[model samples]
Target: MATINSSIVIISLPAIFKGIGLNPLEPGNVSYLLWILMGYMLVTAVFVVTFGRLGDIYGRVKIYNIGFIVFTAGSIALALDPYSAGAGAMWLIVWRVVQGVGGAMLFANSTAILTDAFPVNKRGFALGINQVAAIAGSFIGLIVGGLLAVVDWRAVFFVSVPIGIIGTIWSYKSLHEVGTSTKSSVDWPGNITFAVGLTAVLAGITYGIQPYGGMTMGWLNPWVLAAIIGGLALLVVFVMIELRVANPMFNMHLFKIRAFTSGIFAGLLAAIGRGGLQFMLIIWLQGIWLPLHGYSYEDTPLWAGIYLLPITIGFLIAGPLSGALSDRFGARAFATTGLLLNAATFLALLVIPVNFEYWEFALITGLSGIGSGLFSSPNRTAIMNSVPANQRGSASGMAGAALNAGSSLSIGVFFSLMIAGLSSSLPGAMTAGLSQNGVPANIAAQIGQTPPVGSLFAAFLGYNPIESLLGPTGVLGSLSAQNSATLTGQTFFPELLSGPFHDGLVLVFVVAAAMSVIAAVMSITRGSRYVHVEEAVPEKGASVPQPSTRSV
Candidate 1:
């Protein structure tokens, strides 16, 4: 519940940044921009394993109750931020980090709490519902953010405050302490190494999208290279430490289980396939296609959400049903099929133009959503079920880490691909189209030099680029009135960019399709499921190992 509540805040971020008047393109604001956009996930990824270990020491309910309070406090802080634009972004980042900490507490233990409360036979159904709620909440975040960003950006943050307060009180009053606990010293080496390593990797990925001087993207930036390589090195050290530590932060042994390993990989790949698709679709519809089709750019955000409703609807229909059926039929079959369906959907999208008709987009998106829904629930169930009752908390946390990290990683990869495609074609296309439309040769060339990715974001934010392109001194004065009007008209920029943008979209879809197919093949290799340790043993009478009891 707390995690879902935080998701609403995340979805509202683009509008929040816009409302505060920060230009998304400016490097000065990009750090804060990413913090607001990805801070929650970064914080959550850093803290989830740590907190899950803590829950094994302290009571899960105790940590969860505190989480509710912390989350609410963060929400209130975000709503009350006093600065404007860049300064406002800083304030929000601080509070968002706080919220992520609380969210980590909630997410780390939610599945374990359910596992402790439910019997083995009933665990699948219970976790399936929770999985459904989580997916639904992400979709709801978009709609809620759109509505609130329309009314007032602060309202998006404020909405969470009230819900967090209610959840805090409810958690305190109703939830009971049920999970086993131990008292052990914190694993500082493991915790610090893991945090620093993951942060470096994620930061590197995020920065890779930004343009470098004379380069389309920052993949070769020295700092980016250092961060990524250093992060991986630290991760290797962390793993070595884990093997040596008496009380490791993460149990390296968990990967030995076939179901557990396959499920985690499937979750990661599926997330990679779908995570950026939402952002891409929204940009395509609102920033480019919708404007060309006569809808004012300002109205695109809300309509983008509405038009994407079919995808969410498809998920709602498929997730729980497949989850339920998977318990009977087994996860391997359903998960594999879902991946194949998802791959097909992406390939189908590859052939369509960026300015495709509504039905074509709706159908493809809906199909992809169904595939995601089908994969998510069953895959999660498999991961959770593979563990013993006592290890459920850590197991679930590991699974979530893969999903969240893969998502951030996906954004980096897809954005880089799109920007690369645009860099090759957008500048030339812009110059030719502008010159043909009677723009001065020098001005057209200058505007062509402007980063295409920034223009994409401008359209996403619904800004009138003419204001940015021409200063108040009026560059248009030199041009004929007819030329100026044609340049500033709604269709001008969108129409010009459509062909180049379509090329980029096709490239991204092709890559996504290939990845989805690989995910399906991996999922298929998982074979059949097994019941948790306490409930059943093989008919051949082989013994399942019980997790040895230990202090946290």
Candidate 2:
């Protein structure tokens, strides 16, 4: 449910915006759209480490059980939102942040719980299933959201109610704490610094993609610069505090373990690449491809989700098999090979045309998914296994933090890249197209000069780009009816956008491919299978084998 909620809101955004009487693409509402899209992720990234430490100090089952209740309540609140327009968006964003809090708790401890229950040899398979569910849930949510939003926007939130209730009850009744608990005081200073610093950095990145001061992006905005630099400074302070503290929120010592450190770095890189790919593909399908093929803007979201099923199928097929094999053959080979395959697929996607055949798109995406699945499970298992039993919760939390942070970072980085690419060519093309359609040259130039971010949002939210751009200016009312009709037709904006959008897509995919290649290198350097073993000392004063850190 947590994982599903992370992505369901994305596909249902159009319905939610419509139901709330707001246009997400409008200048006033783009922040709302961005916040709704990224707030949950940011909060989750900021809090997962703290929550994971709480689980270690208290109990994993206890924290997880409470999370279910919190999550269900947040879902109920979202469905019962009473306001419209900005108030409505604020209501949902607040509740979504609450939901993220719940999600952080679940994400932080689930792997620790699994590690406690499964034997070392079987841990990979167990973690594989859990990892697959988390990853696949995002894709599944897209389809589910599309289906549910068709009935009612509220149904997207409502769908989680019954499942949450049942899961909460079942978890409380059946789950037990099996991992060793550590009694340590919370590192309050470390927590505060880490949370504030990370949140500031991420929030800065989020806003940095917006247009400001007549520039294409807000990177030069005073507040954004301050936030990012100040945040990094605070994070450095956080690390210092952690090193000095008796009980750190994150055990910095764990980085000394090559398996733990390298696996985490690889996972972070992979997540950034994967997150960028998902959003880019959605835009490709909904904004351009589906509309060109005769689907209405309103219908594109549903079909986009449907068309992406092959990727999900690939994950389902490869996750368990590789995970099981990794248990015996070691994680380094499987995880490294998976990342290489992932990089290959990204390069393949780069070569594919913007309006490529469905079969080709599906085949490449499926291969990418397979690569992701193979890497995710084994890398996660290796990280968990490298840690001592008492540090499982912390280790798991660190892993979750890496994934969430990478995802949030990806949105800011990749969107900016795409926006930059579009900004270079879109304005002239838009002006030419609009002028040719009988719009006054001055008005066409004015609309064309609008930042490409708005158009990108329009495309992302399945809105009629021409209508949204012209409606507020009242230009459509002034134009001849035939001209207006032509302007608002499904094909005009998309057809004009195809070339510029392809330029952006090429840039985005190339960067993603590079990140994947770097990730593969990190994965390869993680070394062979190495699990930390605790040997009991004999009472007869016999020498016990010290825990070996050597590769198997």
Candidate 3:
């Protein structure tokens, strides 16, 4: 339930910007939109390790309950946001960050609690179900956001309120600690450095897609450059500190275990490919394709979610079944093969047209989802199985950090690439299209050159760019009513943008495909199965119990 709610917020965030009457493509507006969408993940990534360490020091269940409360409060605040543009965005951003802290607590401890509750032999099934819920929640958010955007944007946030309340009460009443606990000093220095460094890096990436001065992309912006460079430098220092600290937040030596390292790296890379690709696909459908195909922008979000059901369907079919099978056979073959299949699916997507046939697009996406589901369970189980019970909390946090960080990176990189591609061709195309539609040439040209990122965001938010650009004061103001109406009509702008938009999409898919292939190759290098020697036990009836069989 926590995973579902968290993911719903993630999927719904971009759409919320549009609901609040902001253009997602415009630099100022896009900045706010991006922060609102990525802030939760950013905060969650920064705090998960710290919270995981706390789970080990305090009780996991105790911290997890507090997470539920924080998340619920954030949801209520989001539903009640009273301003627009900057103030409204700040309110959402602050609350979203708080919600992320809650999500981190839940994410950091849920697996630990499950590991304590379930025996080793049955852990795969439990985790698989949990994984399904997480993925399902993301899809559910898209559907809900689309449906509620028509009634009121606030409905999406409110949806979580009742659920959060129920989940908090239920979790408090029923969940308890069955796992071992240990006392350790908090790694305050390590925590602060890690949080600030990651925030700077991610924030830089988020803004790097926005326009700066005359440049369409912010990568050249001095502040953004500093953030990226500074973030990397601090991370280097963080590693050095971890090696010397007694109660290090992150264990540097875990990479010595090949299975653990490979699993984590593969998970991170896959998440980078998947997370960004998901958003790009949603924008393609909701912002451009759906409107061009006859669905109103207002109706696009719900339908886009419905169209994406196939991906979730593929996951539903594969996750539990593969997890169950992995219990008997080692994860090596299944995991490697799954990633290979995933890489192939990415290549297939690269070749497909942006305005693709439904069946073809659905099949390809479903195939990718199946591959992801196949890889996830066994890979996670393998990593967990190879670690000592005492280290699971920290180990799990490390794995999760990789995934979350990869997701943030993917969003930044993919958005930059898409914007770059669109900027190269969209202006000329938009100018021509608008001119041909009876708009004045200068006005059309100016609007076309308004930066492709802004247009993309406008579509993402379900707002028509023509409406925003021509708002009563621009070129449309001097024109006859008939020309203005024709220029700003529902079909005019969507039709004008489709060609260049499709071009941008092709580039996005190619990048995703390459990333997926690299991740697959990395997964293959994990090598044969091995258990942690420290956890191994002597034969039964011997003087000492075997370390591997320490369940009792």
Q: Per the 3 Å backbone cut-off, how many clashing residue pairs does candidate 2 have? A: 0
Q: Provide the lDDT at 5 for model 1.
A: 48
Q: For model 2, what is the C-alpha lDDT against the true structure? A: 0.89
Prediction RMSDs, each to the true structure: 3.8, 1.4, 3.0
* Local accuracy of candidate 1 as per-residue lDDT tens digits, 188-285: 99999998999899889888887788776788999999999999999999999988998888778878777888888888877777776766776677
Please list the C-alpha lDDT of all candidates, in the order they appear. 0.76, 0.89, 0.76
Report how far off residue 41 is in candidate 1 (Å): 1.9
Give per-model TM-scores. Answer: 0.93, 0.98, 0.92
Which of the predicted structures, 1 or 2, would earn the higher TM-score when compared with the native? 2
Looking at model 2, residue 173 earns an lDDT score of 100
Residue 537 in model 3: shift from native, Å? 8.9
Q: With candidate 1 superimposed using the best TM-score fit, by how many Å does residue 305's alpha carbon deviate from the native?
A: 1.1
Ranking of candidates on lDDT, top first: 2, 1, 3
lDDT of 2 at 132: 93
Q: Which regions of candidate 1 deviate over 4 angstroms? A: 1-14, 464-466, 472-474, 535-552
Which pairs in model 1 have colliding backbones? none
What is the alpha-carbon lDDT for the whole of candidate 1?
Answer: 0.76
